[model samples]
Target: MKLDFDGIRLQAPFYDETHREWRDSVVRPFIDKEIVPHIEKWEKDGDIPLEVYQRAGEVGLFQTGYSEAYGGVTDGVDIFHALITGEELARPGAGGVAAALTVHSIALPPVINFGSEEMKKKVAPGVIKGTHHISLAITEPSGGSDVGNLKTTAKKDGDHFIINGSKTFITGGLKANWFTTAIRTGGEGIGGISLILIPADAKGVSRSSVGPKQGWICSDTATIYFENVRVPADQIIGKENEGFKIIVNNFNNERIGMAAGAVAYSRVCFEEAASWAKVRKTFGQPLSKHQVIRHKFAEMLRKINSTQAYMDICGWHIKNGTPNAADIAMLKVQATKTMEFCAREAMQIMGGISYVRECKTERIYREVRVMAIGGGSEEIMRDLACRQMEL
Candidate 1:
């Protein structure tokens, strides 16, 4: 009778008992108290309030993958903890909230990886405390999945670098207190790119709200523009020309998180459809009475189950720091497909209610497009997987 995913093979060799307790004590309670009640309001409002993150921080939800010295409970890429967070996050019915709250996961990693001790002392602790919002900006106006083609340029003079150009489809952009922005410092292609931390309050920095959007309204998507904004040279993350590798690595983890969220989202859709099939009747019987409907539900379950297994495998590899790029890339493709498939079938089972805002399925259906598009597109994921495998 329990609806939660008991069969989920989390592929966690890394998650010890402490992480499991963290999931039950911190993650699940936050979902029940804060997210579930207000998610529909957030969807209608087109953005989650900043207070949500503060609350997440208050409860220690925002501190994972951060260090003990900076008010963070965990350090390094604690993949299992992140996965648990993503799984619980799936219950919110809005991927936007999940993405928006967790933007720091991508945004701060480069800084933590490459910044000075003073910078880390100043930034990471404040951000971990939920008083700050950070965005990872790599996608330029001209480039979506292609990070190397980004045209936004950062030119250095004196002790400062002047940043120019724009970025679009930026999750949490409208609300970010600071940005780990990708900019061109050299000539064309990958070697030319560098990342600089751009404070939102900086001069020449501007943002505009984007989207009445397909989904993720709970996230404040925006387009940001920089017209020769001056930043201190120390704001640069790592060496100027070394950013391409950082961006690529950042993307792989982001994609893995997306894959995890997608798997959880698919499970939600399947659970909803399964429940509906037993209650909603046609021809004087429940929808499950029909063999065709049963088959469809079975297929949906199969996809969710299959992708979860594969994602678990990838997660195990990542936890131990032996990531196989092809495996993770394929997980991205398969997981997104599962989300899309389950969303479609859940709608079919629920009928008219599913089409309306009354049911969570409509929101999820709109969101499935983004899972396929963001963190790298499905097409890009396939090519990368194939290239890595030499297939």
Candidate 2:
């Protein structure tokens, strides 16, 4: 049994034959051959080799949901393509690897949508081709998820802006060649913020590993510091002081991808536990024969199916052009909580073996916290949903 809710062939209205073919022929084979075998070493090293991104690019993975002008195949691809990418990537149970490979998803949008033609040509082609690394920098040492209260300041000189601040918990920060960063430019609060692209090698720019994290060990999270980094004035992405709206709109897609990954990860836990239970005999028969174990599987399936359903609905909403921030926010919280539940149950069913590093369940259990916390925390998502509803 595949036992994966996402892979169960639900005939989701959003995904057609092309999407399935891509998932089966391209995404699954790539994960099995490239990711599953070497994930342990990458996790131990705190990063994947740069060539992984290059290989992914060569296979059209990064181009799935982007625009054709900028090296994407968006003529036929839609929101579902992006969702499928996230789901299949999470199948490896290596969220860090997925994050590292797709950091440009969040990082390059501002440039693609709002940057000058020169800026777009300079970065998008290389990024889409998998030869460049780009990441977004918004969370600061002090701000955490409070984008409105960011303290990073950028003072403009004749031809350059002097940046001074630090961002922490930045995924792919150590290896990123360019950063699509948020900084304070006008005054206090969200109205004053602006987005700028800062090269990693700029003078006075420095970064250090955030050190060992609880999960996402394979991701290169870092604490990036800027003392007096000078960025060309034209490097600003979008209009100055109007970047807050961009960030807000960007959160919807980010949360959607996070939710999709969470659901797939839950299914991974289910598959692992189900396979384990079928063979490991207990008192007399297999563990799956036991009532309690069967009940556990039932509960896992319920949550996984519900999450997948919500994910499909949300994808449809996005495709049809709906105001879905509130719905997406709530779905993010729902998906992460479901993932957390499934992971805990899988660990319980597998017993001590789930606690060791050798199993996907073990790595997934460690990774659940980051899923809930990153993109946006569960608490933040709930509050954002309420606020979007004007509650």
Candidate 3:
């Protein structure tokens, strides 16, 4: 029997011809040619080469949902289009490729939405062209999800702000041209936070790799140090002491993209396992013939379909500009949990062979924790959802 992997995707009303074309024609071919062939080498090298980013830019991969003036293809793009991009990027099952290639998605939005024309002119074009790289520096060594309590400080000086602090677990940090950074410029807590654009080559800016990680090895995580790094005061992305709201708003898109990727990764796991089971024999016949293995496929498909539906509704709400932070938060948790379950079951079904790097399930199994913990920990997501529900 043939296993229909595409049939696993829900027939959601939100996806039209454009979405399908973008997935099937644009992103899918790109991943098949540019990414899939080199995932193992890149993973072993601990970082993806800069050429991949330039190639992605040449194909308009980085331009979706961005402004036309800055080389973004906005006329036909919507939230679902962006989500489709995320889903396609996850197809190779090397989460590091997706994370490293798309780090600009998290970093550039604040600049586009809240930055001055000068800032936009300086930052957006080169990044969209894939000639330059940028990273969002929000997760400090002292905290991850606790954005309000971050300890990075920026003291005002003549015509500049003296930034003196650090950020950890920063994706693409080592090669970034600029950092859309969160710095403390006021008193304390959330009220004191502000966003700033700091050139990575500035006088006191330095970084070291936070590598040998459990996963995302090709993404090049870093622990950045700022020792009295003096950046012009006007480099602030938005008004001082009002950055918390911007940060909160940014999480909605990030979480949505992550959710799309997570659900897609879950589907990848299901597809890999099912393909393996159909051929791998056990007691008397193929593993796919076993009642127990068939049940595993059933459970995996059930969760994958449900999560895709949830993601679609959330995407619709976001496209209509009525995004609920709570629902987006919860959807992230749901997608990651679904990924965890599918990965575990897929590994079990594949048995010892699944433990090797040759299979996508092995890499996906290693990546489940990062998906659950990176955007927001499952515990933090649940608590945030409940708090937003006013429970």
TM-score leader: 3
Global Cα lDDT for candidate 1: 0.84
Candidate 2 residue pairs in backbone clash = none
Instruction: Show model 2 residue runs off by greater than 4 Å.
Output: 1-10
Positional deviation of 24 in candidate 1, in angstroms?
1.5
Each candidate's TM vs. the true structure? 0.95, 0.97, 0.98
Clashes of each: 0, 0, 0
Stretches > 4 Å off in candidate 3? 1-4
* C-alpha RMSD for every candidate: 1.9, 1.4, 1.1
Tens digits of per-residue lDDT, candidate 3, 1-391, equal: 3454565777889999999999888888888899999999998899899999999899889999889999898998899999999998988899999999999999999999999999999999999999999999999998898999999999999889999999999999999999999999998899999999999999999999985998898899999999999999999999998898898899899999999999999988999998899999999899999999999999998998888999999999998989999999999999999999999999999999999989988988899999999978899999999998889
Best by lDDT: 3
Please provide the root mean square deviation of candidate 2 (C-alpha atoms, Å). Answer: 1.4
Model 3, residue 22: what's the lDDT? Answer: 91
